[model samples]
Target: MDKNTTDTPTEYYDVLIIGAGISGIAAAHHLQEQCPDKSFAILEAKESFGGTWLTHKYPGVRSDSDLHTFGYRFKPWTGAPIATGDEILAYMKSVIDDDGLQPHIRYQHTVESASWSSEENLWTITARRSDTGQSLRFKTHFLWMCQGYYQHAEGYTPQWQSMSSFKGQIIHPQTWPEDLETAGKKIVVIGSGATAATLIPALAGKCAHVTMLQRSPTWFTTGRNANAMAEELRLLDIDESWVHEITRRKVLRDQALFVQRTKEEPEKVKSDLLAVLREHLGNDFDIDTHFTPRYRPWQQRVAFIPEGDLFKAVREGLASVVTDEIDSFTTHGIQLKSGKHLDADIIVTATGFNLSVLGDISFTIDGEPLNFGDTITYRGMMFTGLPNMVWVFGYFRASWTLRSDMVGDFVCKLLKHMDANNARKVTTELRPEDEGMTLGPWIHPEDFNPGYLARGMHLLPKQGNKREWQHTHDYWLDKDDFPAIDLNDPIFSYAR
Candidate 1:
């Protein structure tokens, strides 16, 4: 590691990873294990680690997917299937400590821009030190982006008329107050996404009453907190590695089958989900208005409820769901388009996230600004016409870490290949033969319509009709294709 005075600035490395979050750590681990001789560093915009897990500290914050699948493949998660924010952060800290990744991580180094030189076969990156407000520069052969998709600065919150007239406190879950006082307060939470689902049950017990207001209902599913198979294996004193492997495979298989059923038999899957909710909430509940979504299952992510806690809260009258459009906010509460008014002492907005690609970093290739919208995504990882750069984009259908692990491994493999061939740079460019291929959206509009992605579609990279240029949400397809992909393909051109 080299550090110069603010007067003169520039450092170089074999690889420079942006974001010290889950994906960034995974990338670092793979690079270290696969290419021990190579030098690398991790630059994080935040002052600490854990990325999303660390950023969100709202009540009932936990993983929607099972930890076994969400956790890294190299590291085994010994906790319950659904882990809390603190537990996940602890797990990541352990990985960093165990792997000695602290020394290589440079927190508060927010990258502002990157310029790639074709003749030099290197990238010049400019970042700002958040603490000192000093400009820093670095050069690297390869750039690895693992900053996840969502914008961390702020979540998506819609503007409501007369919002400031309300005398009570208004909060967004992304910026939850540490000393928030909610005991016996009538709380109204806006939005029916995962955050609202998780917060409703959690705040119900402490608040006078918690109401979830949604414009439309979202699909919700129940999952157990503990893993029965892992518990059984533990009782038999089986090896920890063996237990983790068995449980991980079992969870993945079950999840994959469920996703497959949802795609192949939408009606059956929807009915099953509604039946489970009806059984938990009873016959008198308005299941259609509050539980059933108009869209098909898996069009958006299905919110997970551990042990039916949300349903149980609603059943016991601690919480309620209000399906209505917001006309506007009243001084005391929110007024619905149906002429109903809700009285609340506090309002919490759990709207959604603001999606961003590559951490919103500016890019210039050969002194020319690179517009991602004009570029096509190559193999869902690399961008077409981009050289020595890879972005870690996880699966929307399955656990995020599953795709993270694969991208990390693939990067390692590419690095090894480059070293063996003595190539200075590897670039993915559209070939002349590929000119006939049809250009399409990165993701199918109907497939996934999360608010963040919908709002940021124009800024993201496009996809082609061909498989090599498209991103498949299926983990099974990516698992078999990513590692086995021919790096020497005509689409990917290498040069010394």
Candidate 2:
């Protein structure tokens, strides 16, 4: 039966934004200011806000990238370069409160599905309200999906054979137990990414013996994750634009230089970096087994834990590294392929997460379901033939917020153009000539699988030079092209 219509208020939001993370909040904040008269609401899935910052609770979780470059240019980092989870969360809250965005947000409203109504020229979004446990729908002209991958805080862990019979308690870093009693307990962390690298040292301080299990090695570098020039800019009493330019330029230059040094003179840079690790581990440690990565530099994300601190944790007897493949689990502990048994009370799966395409939500256009695999990405911003919508996804090669910032401004400009011309709907579709275009594997080839790896590798847009088809991966080029993009181009035509 049709639910009670009298009790439910029927309101129209001009724009509907999904997720309350950094990207979503930034979009909302900008949209709220530009279109105050137009109704808008940010529909969040969780009870409270702070998307990734709110979810990731693992110990030693912090940004490896410099905060000045990592954070929003509109909001400068008041503290150190690299910030902890708490500090980042505080910064988000500060932005929300200062902008007075409380009234515009409806928390605990998890969006289940969204479809475009070509007949009505509006997007009907369905969501489940957490508090009342009631189903609600909102009709809006535009939908902004900023809900990132992993669908909140759920980490991925595969089931190993004979693992259930093991006496040890299994834990995932994503949902780390707050009341975990790791003290004096033998712990084994499985996986070799940044999470496992970060957790080993943090848990080592308290646990009796911490062993880091790795299937493959990663290039590790630890440095100050902050912009040095940013601090100097603030002190010099220079203009904000000047501060932004100097900071952004220095960061880009440094990152480029780092890539250059590694690629041009591999032996020198490699020896120097490995020497640092070797020195930290002392002469007795095996460099080949413990430090070297299988792939070239930057092929995978380089793990950073503050200058061989994780290695130091291992060297000082706080933690130990075990490079092996898991064979099976015994009643007391995990058994490696080499017939070595590691007795442990707890096992942490620092495995990884699923690469969700548009946050695992299905899109439909005019009663027809949209298949992402069949469609090619348009200019790395919008998808082909998906009318009246633009999805903003950040670049993997550079900082996320940097690319997202440009996307946000471009959208605002598009909205302004739509308003001026009295347009009802706007959509960007790739030119027919650009169909069937492919891109390089977003995930490392060795790590490729049909499940999680397929989405990122197969669906990511190809890098190009044309503003419409190009993904320059250069910030200056994006700023020049996107900011000056002509919204009234014949390809993106307005409808009555």
Candidate 3:
């Protein structure tokens, strides 16, 4: 309860964490073990605890991947696999409560800037309270940034030309207006990712008609969101560790098998996946237009629904899919490039998120501006020139939490190594030969918008391994090698 410790330069905390989301929470949980006396404060932009989980509450917002590997490894989920937003939020809140982490959290404090001071060996953080707009400054020796991309919790909704002229009310699923009534209205959902897929089905049941508008195709799959195997294990008299291992391996195997099979032969995999989707949709579903995806299976995040509920909604005549280029917005509805018009009373734009690096917050080391564009990503956790800073960004190819957990473990180990050595700061430095490496498109460079893409391939690490760069996006490899990674190696040195 050290609120408003802003009269003078606040007491120097050994560690400072930005964003109280899962990643930040995990960081604090482990950081305490390494340096128990080191004070740490988690500065959150919002008023509440759950970062993305509480922020995004769109109609069918849930995890596309399984929950077993999507959360902290230290804490296992006792419920279903693909958890809903509410469930995930509750889990996050429980972690805060169970660990007594509320005292470390300072809510409504939005970080505006953080600059490293070489002379003082500390970081000066400036933040303003969201409610009062009062600015405060805090200092920390080590900083961990965990805030995610996306400016607002209420997802992104683009301005369609002449959208205002439309006769109906428009709704972006991200900021779903609680007061706006949607009962018996004709709804048109834009985009084909998880949000669109989830929303189409959830809205179809209540709406008079629903139309899913997609510019390009995306890989879609059907599975039971809930983990049946876990439930069965719970009913039986089995060891808890055995249950965890069984569920973990099962989920991992299922996801790995699907990815491997799809990668072995993309065309056949695409055809078969589409075929399954078509069958789920029945004769009424449009296979030629809706079921086909333009990209390969893993190019983008696939859409998953519990037991083909979206397809069921389509077959039940509650919703339909339209795969066409959007021309523009009409007075009463949308005009498609196919010269077709669809009337809608409510329009939900689920186009996707605007991905930003380091929560799009700019950083500086000493007096020089740290150009993220020129910096090379080291281990997907730290940048080359960034000293005393560690980042937690997940791999798009695998489970997000897998990399997060690994990074978390590695960071804790790194912290312990630093504490034992009495080192104040540690940074990743790349040799000149390691420059000019190209990173894969999994991180999506073009996704940057509204002044967020400060770094490109120059910033991201290379796809393949070359000693200093460990781009092992694989979970199993990380579990095996991450803890054993040489923290005391001369290449990565520490300064007192």
Candidate 4:
């Protein structure tokens, strides 16, 4: 079916995936393997396939999580666990090529609004060509929101006092310019998250001197890129696929224990993490002032630095860290409350991102505007009152694609079950047992509270007290919980 930028109606499919990222790709694979009869197409907003990987062109941009778990379960990751953006994109392209999913993907097709018609029992989508400025329409039986959570157009940069006073160019890592000169420049990178950690190392030797300016410290874990278990297995002449599966399970088990340790013994966990930090910067560096984090481990994401590159850059004098409040921005540099000033020719704001609710798409159900915040979630994937729709919002603590794979299985299974029952409309409903259940924020701040999530909490859907109603960030629990979901459960409302 050809996508018409004109007013002509396009061919309808059994399923329509919203993005061509990892989640969308995984969904396509599952639909082909599990729901063979289901016809589907992927609508991508970007000019290419990779979502975050394609958008983020910052130097040293790489996977925050290892590729063994981050990569699709069906695909064998033969490269290093922590892969580069190019490597990950190549891996995705391989999936697209090998699976023959290219023709189904329409790039630069940005979906602007979606409406679900009960009378017609179908979804009418309004999208625009990012390259053409022309509107198009797509109709499908089911809508899969795999567009991801954060706004990719711009990263969230805080408005510091007197920011306009600074004479140097200010850049965000999310939209890093290709032509921006870095050689022999004195740069100051604000924010101590993963982006800052990655950019500081890549910009180290290139810049005259780079300084990482953070109001507070963030947790970082150091590790080598290679997986020793997978290496030993491969040495025994085992198949690469088997090695990938075995290595992925072991890594996930280790991550689960690490998450448990962070909660059960936060101080011990903090001590172990600090010990790793000390190994990089030595015992004499001001670890307490500049490296020590105020919050408990895992409250925010702990960035993994390959061989402690950021700290190595700091120790070797290529980069420096400043732990002080920004009093104001001066003409040449930032003014610190401690009466210290640092010179910078360029400022990189590595501040996180803004969370986007359902890709910022205006949705309507039965001709009435749908407010996602007014609805409750079903295991963070499906929502109440939204029939025949599933949103692939992935896990925060674990590799994002882990849940994407899980949802792929769940969606395919549910579609088959609906087929068996001959149902056209299916939506989630609060069970009688859940009548008095407490509804909370999308994610508990205690479990995870990154700056973006904190700022966008109210804009997200509500989570109930039960397992069936919340977005459980725990992948270990969900691996079992999702497969055990009964198709005939009272929480599911199905209609012909």
Quantify all predictions' global Cα lDDT against the true fold. Answer: 0.90, 0.74, 0.74, 0.92
- What does the lDDT come to for candidate 2? 0.74
Task: List TM-scores for all candidates, in order.
Answer: 0.97, 0.90, 0.91, 0.98
lDDT of each residue in 1-496, candidate 4, tens digit only:
3344476666688999999998999999988889989999999999989999998999999999989999999999999999999999999999999999999998998999999999989999998988877788889999989999998899988898999999989999999999989988899999999999999999999989999999999999998889999999999999999999999999999999999999999999999999998888999999999988999989999899997899889999999999888888989998899999988899999988989999999999998999899899999999999999999998888999999999999999999998999999899999888988998999999889999999999998999998889988989889999999998998999989
Better of 3 and 4 by lDDT: 4
- Collision count for each candidate, in order: 0, 1, 0, 0
Q: Model 4 off-target regions past 4 Å?
A: 1-5
**Ordering by lDDT:** 4, 1, 3, 2
Q: Score residue 455 of candidate 1 by CA lDDT.
A: 87
Q: Model 3: residues >4 Å from true position, as ranges?
A: 1-8, 239-241, 432-467
> For model 3, where is the 10-residue window of minimal lDDT?
446-455
Best by lDDT: 4
Candidate 2 lDDT trough over 10 residues, lowest sum: 442-451
True-structure lDDT of candidate 4 = 0.92
lDDT of 3 by residue, 1-496 (tens): 2444446456568788988887788787777755677789999988887777777777767877777777667676887777889998888888788888999999998887889987887899888887876778889888888886556645556666777788887776667777777788988889887888888887887878989998876778886767778888879966656666788878888877877777788898888888788778766566867777666777566667778988888888888889887788988789988999989888888776555567666678897877775555666677776888888876555667677667777877777788889888787765566556554432343332111223233444333235346554556666777777898765475789
For residue 78, give model 1's deviation from the true position in Å.
0.9
lDDT of 1 by residue, 64-170 (tens): 88899999999989999998999999999998998899999999999999999999999999998988877889999999999989888898899988888888989
Clashing pairs in 4: none
Q: Relative to the unseen true structure, what is the C-alpha lDDT of residue 473 in candidate 1, on a scale of 0 to 100?
A: 79
